[model samples]
Target: MDLSNIPKPIWYALTAFLLLTIGYGAANHVPGLNSSDKESAENKASTVPNSSSVKVSVFDEATQAPVVGAKVIVESQGGSDTDTTDNLGAFRVQIPTTDYVKVRISKNYCEPYNQDLNLKSNPDRPKPIFLKCSVPQKKYMPSS
Candidate 1:
């Protein structure tokens, strides 16, 4: 290979092509440098697994009726999930797989209920929460 005889422009073009090939290869093949769209998608999927749709239903304990507008809070290792009861007094939430979680239910004029539930065994089952409700005594007036 005699470099003294070769033209300068031709050498520069060849050098540029070689550098580009190496840079592209490194960007696609290197571990940390090769963060493509596919790798990011896989990372997102691997972050959470074994998630289940846990159905939660809130009801009035005294009347045994559905309690609308009730707040349902589920605390787990991943994070806390909260939702208000709909017209059917039910809502579905995604709970990541864990040993146990704290479930809290609260509504107006009702005693808040708190409990720890283990949903690992059966995660798809509907959990019914009963909130004790109370009514204030009515006052009477006598006129002479």
Candidate 2:
């Protein structure tokens, strides 16, 4: 390709236009990149007033004891909220009233739990989750 015929100003203008086009495309298509922090916060605030508070309690399936320090993540189209269970093995989160949410619970010592919740159709309190995990075993070796 020969570029000697093209003027420097035209080349600079073409480069600027290409950059602007790419930036606009990325800002529109990429998630979380299009909106400013304040705008995103405002959007969340507008939806939160109509949200419902969902409480989740975790327990061990074997012993039925409360599972403490478990991590709970609730996700929906709006966003996601994460919390850790306290000594009572319970955590609460606010989710939009009309969206379906995916709830995930995890603990190092117990099996992970996942459930899909329909907040609009159900409109009822969620059920508690119980995790079942196998007991860890130790290995023994003969001394040399």
How well does candidate 2 score on lDDT at residue 50? 67
Residue-level lDDT tens digits of model 2 in 41-102: 32352347667777777888998888899889888776677878979888777666656779
Predicted structure 2: clash tally: 0
Which prediction has the highest TM-score against the true structure? 1
As for model 2, its CA RMSD to the true structure in angstroms is: 14.7
In model 1, the Cα lDDT at residue 24 comes to 99
The residue pairs found clashing in candidate 2 are none
> What is the alpha-carbon lDDT of model 1 when measured against the actual structure?
0.76
TM-score of each: 0.58, 0.57
TM-score of 1: 0.58
